[model samples]
Target chain A: MAADLAHLSPLLIVCCVGLGILLLDVFADPKQPKTFIGYVAVVGLLVALAATGWLFATGGVLLTQPYFAVALTLDPFALFGFALILVVAILTTLASVHYLPSQRCEWGEYYSLVVFASLGMMVMVAAADLITMFVGLEIMSVAIYVLAGFKRQSPFAIEAAMKYFFLGAFATGFLLYGLAFVYGATGSTNLNVVAEHFAKNDPGLYGIVIVIMMIVAFGFKIAAVPFHMWTPDVYEGSPSPIAGLMAGGVKTAAFLALARVFLTAFGGADFENLAISWREVFYWLAILTMTVGNILAVVQQNVKRMLAYSSISHAGYILIGIVASRSVDGGAVAGSGLFFYLLAYALSSVGAFAVVSMLGKDGEEDITYGNLAGFAYRHGFAALCMVIFMASLAGIPPTAGFLGKYLVFTDALAATHMNLLPLVLVAVVNSMIGVYYYLKVIVFMYMREPRREFETIRSVPMGIAFGLAALVVVVCGSFPDTTIRWSAKAATGNPSADSAISAASVIDVPAPVATTAK
Target chain B: MEQVIFWILAIGTVASSVAVIVPPMGRNPVHGALSLVVAFFFLAGLYVMLVAHLVAVLQVLIYAGAIVVLFLFVIMLLNIQSEDLGHPRPTISKLIGVIAVGFVSIVLIGFILKDKGMAEPPVGLPSDSTFGTVKTVGNLLYTSYIVPFELTSILLLVAVIGAVIMAKRRL
Candidate 1:
């Protein structure tokens, strides 16, 4: 139907772009330049972004029909994810243009793989069925595995890939096993169907066990404490642009999916009243992940490793937002906080990695804290951009990260009224710890003395991309209203204000069992 | 009879899986590969008990028959001997491994404890008329899961291409 086609247009465009890139790689002369492929991929991503905006403006949910029979809900939530993914994809593609060439490893397949990975990420955040989510997760992960080991001759790259693959597959096993347990309890893989089952049936012990398994599975994807070992090594070994993609794009998608599953599906009065509580699990995880990640980052000499740990810590902060959203009193405010934080974090982190990508020569840079000394003297603009990024990451004032942290703190404070004060205090202490390393980068760039001669690579396209990201960082920080309001509206779940409150309460209590067999 | 068979295979599976991980003094790669095959076979037997007959067959066919053979071929091609096993990695690596395994075990035990009261008799009786036989499974695969089934073929094709690309001497 025309309606279905219109609703699905963004996803269809991304998939088609992936295929087109593949075909282009195959048919194009072998000797043709690699930048051509990169250009085509960028164009595709930009078009996808434009199409997504058009859908947001005019499509009106594609004739207002749900796709995949309620198994996969194509709604404003999915549209939000689609928009974020396209932005991340375009930024990553722009960063990659300079990055791959600098490494002397410019392969056309790299662009195709990036596009495919973006498509996979879209599917993941949009998925409404467990199987669809699993498939999407694997598709994203497999491409990333290859990209991590793109520098095949480097032993570090190979080791990173091996670790990522082994751990990723292991985590996937946990996810599948968890799904099996949920299926056993609910007799269905659809999120709504499972939620309905939990609402009616006692579920009793099975409910607690399945919820724990699901938490562990999602915990691993988001790199929470105890499941975060793969992150540092992979980020360190990967090309800087790909590292940006993983930290910014991949983590955001996983968190979005996690929110959908936990908040929308397994949440509500029935499950909340049961002996087990997911809030407690997230509460403990958020505290530990933030503390451990920031503590470890402080001891790291390598900039890449430090950033990797910083990302893990940020995951913890984001998890706090997710936990707050599930609280009794906190609703759309918490959800919107998470969305804003995701956008802010993605912009700053990708921009930081973009600068790192520029610093490398022939794909090799032993970028220790000492190596970055006096970088500001040579490349003032790039150094200033990096400073802004680090400042934002540290949640300093007059930057998007500061506003993001403020929103999260506000949500946490709201939750504290519902007896979640411990979580809020833990987040506060973690943010304090995060300030140490984020400032460490600044100290190295400005205060420390350079050990060797500094040279800057000037790539016009990459500079433009980084500049745009930096601009958004400042602009969003200055005028946070428009984006904040949009995110709040999306989180409301109902168009009318009074209806929004009722819908929130209705979702707070799990829906009664209604069999789909009819 | 089924319980007896399950106990036997389960014991074998656990023992071989342990052997695969623990390198006996001077244990050969070929021996490790063989142990892996035995473990796979026992897993197939367990699948049979679970009434996933087609999966059981495929487990034996693909894992024991094909994958282990590939492992053996790789070992032979690389000319890796029992004595070629390098020194154990650093103490930190060993500690990390032990901690990871311990964490997994703790989580598993936690889940088992949580679900102890809700354990139920496994569904899908192991009879040709009731549960999926090979023919029935094939029919369902082609009908209901046809899209994924076809996608799996494409995955296999990609894997083949990837293997060739990886092994090739030059592009």
Candidate 2:
């Protein structure tokens, strides 16, 4: 019990703070600016972030209590995810202080919901059991659904919320049924226990079917292609800052959870001997996601929609990292590449969306390319910041995006069993194709003449958020070694991963049987 | 005698469930909802036969007593009309959708038919007579599963907040 408290302090702090904010909203002065409460939420998140760092330094959650660790464990991987999510929340809160009021939707619950959502992501990354993961996912998804529909007056906002809720609920059903199947096959929901069971017994075809179902469910959350029909509409309808939160923080959490599940539970001998391999599924998924995302983005006139498709394409690149991680010699580099790329993508994306929030003409979403004509002439500094983000996104040199793509591609090339060289070549071609659309945004900003006197609104908080994000993107890109090392540490700290490999090598392949049971 | 009772309850449960969804019967949703109560009652009887007394009670208390009343109240409050529901045309897309659903169902049936493990299931049934009693469930939920049990409260709290915020008349 004593050890459980120590392990759970970070989550406890954030959860208490969120509840405290809700109570404060109920009792505090109604006339006060909601932005002050937003600041308080940011402070609370910073405190939680510090606590996470302290916990990571000490050791994993429930390190002394194995029983509690089965439910939730704050390993280095979880701590890294917590930090990324906190950064997203902080940036989002900063930008929202200016955005919510401008949109006439200023409510204290908005900040509280953001805090609650971050708490959800924290729990999700730390969860070690299927039940715990499902609970955390619901907390996060429910909060996000409310945030998406925050602007109730707009039909588009309502539609976005409704569509996201129904589809997200459907995906959750698939995930729960898949978890049920896994439990039926293995007789355990705890990841390590399941892995140990598979190590001893042949999982047969049941394992492959369950894995595919889980992948499809997670595919929707990460906005992978074929499961990505809702991305553009949701991104366009939600407020810009919330859209940023979904694209950056939510994606990071989902990818981390997916990687943890595949690398830990399914990383053993039984899975290796299966008739169907997950690596091949991911290979085609990556190709289709990249090509389709880039092609659709090329013709999008709306900036928000274009960014949405680009986010999908980035998911493709991250999938490449997952594919490479399956190989014996490539797990560490490829895993680290996934995290590094996520951080880079998060920073640049938040910065880009913050700028977009400021570009609104007469306080509506300024999405059309025509609205951005001659933006460089009117606001030179903001335009320069935007250029940095756009260039980084296009994978230009001396930017974090370029280093991220380089690492992931090299990791793919390092795979010994699979012929991943062709995949890398295809990725390179896709990246080349991606440059055309990304540059077009720059062309509109710098080359075209102002349509209507270059009128726009500027908010200090948004500017601050953009500046900080831009600085990090540049610094990380320039000094990549330390960040890469940190990501590698986060990736390699999974305790079960090493043992699972040794267990896989000694197990004999069993013949298929008519009746399968663990 | 026990086997005869089990077969009777199983047939009743299936018939009531079918009554709830077989259309023109389901076209009037109110009638469909009413039939759902009978289905739940019959399902409770099936659970009783399985010796899952706690689940059987919940199936009655929550599904039959509370949920059915809630559904009827919502239907009355909404005041929906049969005329308001548009008659959707069957198009080529609809045909494709039906075919796709048929394919998926056949595949599912194939998987279900292939797995024969459940046919012989008497190796380790719970020996304790009180396995599915309320006391046993309460103890398990509060002990080993305490964290998830508490987390469920938080999920409910979030749902309440979301509903109040989204459905309130004004900010």
After superposition, the stretches of candidate 2 with alpha carbons farther than 4 Å from their true spots are A58-62, A327-334, A360-363, A453-457, A496-518, B1-22, B35-50, B63-73, B122-128
TM-score of 1: 0.87
lDDT of 1 by residue, B1-171 (tens): 877897899999999998887745346778788889889988988887777788998998889889999999999999976567776566987899889879977966666555543444444453447465888778745643443343344334334433443344553
lDDT of 1 at B40: 94
Candidate 2 collision pairs: none
Residue A72, model 1: lDDT of: 37
Candidate topping TM-score:
2
iRMSD, all candidates: 8.9, 5.9
Top DockQ model: 2
Over A1-518, each residue of candidate 1 has an lDDT whose tens digit, in order, gives 57666666777787778778878878888775677777788888888888778766542252222223232345556677788878777778888886776776666667767877787788777665676677677767777777777666667777877888889888888888789877766765656556556656765555666777788788887899989989999999988888888888899889988987777567666667666478778878998898899999999999999999999999998988888886222233246888888888888888888888778777686778888998887777888888888878888878899889888878777764256577778877878888888888888888877878875457777776777788888888889998787567556542221222232232232333222210
Fraction of native contacts under 8 Å reproduced by each candidate: 0.02, 0.40
Show model 1 residue runs off by greater than 4 Å: A58-67, A273-276, A327-334, A447-450, A494-518, B23-26, B87-130, B133-171
Give candidate 1's root-mean-square deviation (CA, Å): 5.1
Chain A TM-score (model 1)? 0.92
What does the i-RMS of model 2 come to? Answer: 5.9
**Candidate 2 chain A — worst ten consecutive residues by lDDT sum?**
A503-512
lDDT value, residue A77 of candidate 2: 80
